[model samples]
Target: MSTQHDAEIDALLGRYFDGLYHSDSSVLRTVFHTDLSYVNGTDGTYETMGLEDYMARIDARTPPASRNDPREEVVERIALKGDRIGIVEARMTMLGRNYQDLLTLINTDEGWRVLTKVFSFVERKD
Candidate 1:
């Protein structure tokens, strides 16, 4: 049986994926902490951004609603520390690339919120 913590984490991850696909900053906001940071590894370099900047980038883009893209997320691992922190590793396919992301989350009074995301993406050769 899944615990409340498990359910909460699941919901949080779901919202994250949905937010990315739909480009809905509001939905993303609910799951991300105010101090959010994302470190992205691409090509042979790394780029990082804060929550506001990332959300703004999303807001400026056209929503992917018309893309009908496949969102296949595989949760590779989940590690819970004490009761307040969790680290989740997941892989998904998007924009013709396969991405692996590590999300750090914190359990707050309101709920679990993602604090940081470190990810790497590689183009699908197939």
Candidate 2:
């Protein structure tokens, strides 16, 4: 069904947002693949992180929720390539930035997992 991707992606995004809001790498580990790669190029520079470094950075950050920072996310689209490959487009705001994310997914034996995340961010208006 067309809505199925929406449901599954929504659930995944929920966890993603929670992990980010709390800066909880443990929570993120559940949803993100161990091989996940995060990329960002909004500043005209190629910035990227592998899961280990990403998790460590997450662990080191101040939890946005603790600072009462606003949490906002909208899943703009979700589509599947056959049944195994998928992609999700989303926008979110956190930690003084607004981000547009392209999340590549794969339906593993373990269910849908984020394989790679390419994102661009701009500083949020205060």
lDDT of 1 at 63: 66
TM-score of each: 0.91, 0.92
lDDT of each: 0.88, 0.88
Model 2 agreement with the true structure over 62-88: per-residue lDDT tens digits: 999999998898889888898788898
CA RMSD of all predictions: 1.5, 1.5
The lowest-lDDT stretch of 10 consecutive residues in candidate 2 is: 1-10
> How many clashes in each candidate?
0, 0
